[model samples]
Target: MTRRTWPLRAWTLVALAGVLLLSACGEGRQSVLNPSGRDALLLYDLARVMFVGALVLWLLVGGLFVYVTRINPREMSRRLAEGLIVGGGVLFPVVLLGGLLVYSLPLMQAPREADEGLRVHITAEQWWWRVEYELPDGGRVTSANELRLPVGARTGLVLNAHRVIHAFWVPALGGKADMIPGRETYLSLLPEAAGTYRGQCAEFCGASHALMAFETVAMAPADFEAWLAAEAQDAAAPQGEDATRGAQVFAREGCGGCHTVRGTQAVGQVGPDLTHVGSRLSLGAGILGVEAPDFASWIAHTETLKPEVAMPSYDHLPPDDLTALAAYLGGLE
Candidate 1:
């Protein structure tokens, strides 16, 4: 092929490869492309259209550049050149961008009405999320790390920051909203399907910002109601001797000063609530699975897993005691 043709071909191939790579990147549970909510789907559609339009514009500009540089300039007319400059450079962008704005502005306002939706409050901390659900009767349920929504229902999230600025983003559910300290912001999500999605802190906050993630579970309306009811209740008593011993160990080690477990003396609010810890899909802000070994590791060497976390390491505890503690936390469901 000629050199001129080669450049176009190479550019095309690179653009195609980039698009494919981006498409592959969206297969994760937290992908905007794999949208599960009304707002997210709308945003995805807008993005795809904008991307295609941009690609076409890029090719047109590139082709014009190649034609001008590689061909005889004397063969071009002044009228054609001026038309290309004005139409392509000015009119095209104006029309395209103006149309896009008009199309997307309505979508930005299309989330379900918040007054009729389930109200949830999300407080962003340095590396974790504090979640609270407000019932229709004005009662509230508190949870940490995991957000559960009912499928086919509109949920309103009130965002606030306890320590630093953060952004609450569940890519599959909807667009992100910022969490500013002393300021309450809002976002609305309407889950259209029943499945599990992942969410994360879209804004950097601290040393473990990348690890500040959570799980979003969308369930049937009835199931969600039952789950909410269960969450509202205090944690059940430990059933086994190991768990009982572990609870004793937790209390003796001053773990209560940081974490909270309902129906127990551990009511400190310095860390995530552990009321239904065993039922959560992940632990330590989605860093690890809810397993005994992982729990033990987190307790023993928190700094090793998440550097500069507020929780101190419990590595000095006896091995058996650590095991018991892990077992106890694991059974918190």
Candidate 2:
């Protein structure tokens, strides 16, 4: 080989080695192949097989093109034409149907059982998710924008949409499931690891669709039970005159029209159920952190944070009224 060819070949080998190294190092719970749930893993396997098969077919077609055009261009006549026509006509339909069947058969088979699994109903709005869980004794725990699941246990999800169409997808645990308005869709997720996983609304709902996000907290069994019980209990009223004044403002003002807190007179269901608001990690549909200043800004002027939102801005209220409402709402844990 030429001296220059030796260097070029060495660089190509190095580049290929780097790519292999990167592929080897790519490992995570959210990875398509290293899935945390059973159905997700099965789907991953099907996609992988189809991907590899398609790549091989593409390589074969490329080689065929090169051979037909270069080495056999003079001899490519009636026989070659017939071979190309027959091969082209027969290959695509068979490959596509085979791939479709291989990918869809698992979904068509007998559904996986989740007899003892926890059941949660998830409703997706334009840019947020409202999650409700039913306990064993017929009681329930409702939260917004966050989902808590028990690690190593099968969890069944009943999904729907309140306003527009949206898709629920938590890459760590499963695939995308559509939440259609007025119809219920079911999916099962078994989280084997304990961590906060990011989830997003996969469908284009509205302007804030890019910001439509949620978090899945996979806790230990004991911790999950404790959280469930805590969420199910009635919300405690805040103590002291300042807190009392805040509560009065929360009730007197129109904030009670959309939000809810158990044991309080605010039982509106049009928005999130904030029974344990203070204990939650974030607020404003996970757009704002749970903090004093963030709460103040959001409650004062929600329209600024989300343009054209259904909820109106309370910026017209008096400064004291805004402060009192913020304090009271922030204390509902």
| Candidate no. 2 TM-score | 0.83
The ten-residue window of minimal lDDT in model 2 covers 106-115
lDDT of predicted model 2: 0.77
Name the lDDT of candidate 1.
Answer: 0.89
Judge candidate 2 at residue 32 and give its lDDT. 60
- Tens-place lDDT per residue, model 2, 30-94, is 45645665656666676777667776675567556655665445665788688786775466647
- On the 0 to 100 scale, the lDDT of residue 255 in model 2 is 69
Instruction: Compare the candidates by lDDT and give the number of the best one.
Output: 1
Candidate 1 regions with alpha-carbon error over 4 angstroms = 1-4, 75-80
Which runs in model 2 stand beyond 4 Å of their true positions?
Answer: 1-34, 88-100, 107-116, 239-242, 318-321
lDDT of each: 0.89, 0.77
Q: Which digits, one per residue and each the tens of the lDDT, describe model 1 over residues 1-333?
A: 986578777887997998898776856789887899998999999898888878777878877777777754456688998998999899988887788788878888866346577899999987888999998898878899999999997888988998789998999999988999999998889999899999999998888999999999999999999999999889878878889999999999999898889999999999999989999999999999999998999999898898888898999999999999999999988
RMSD of each: 2.0, 4.6
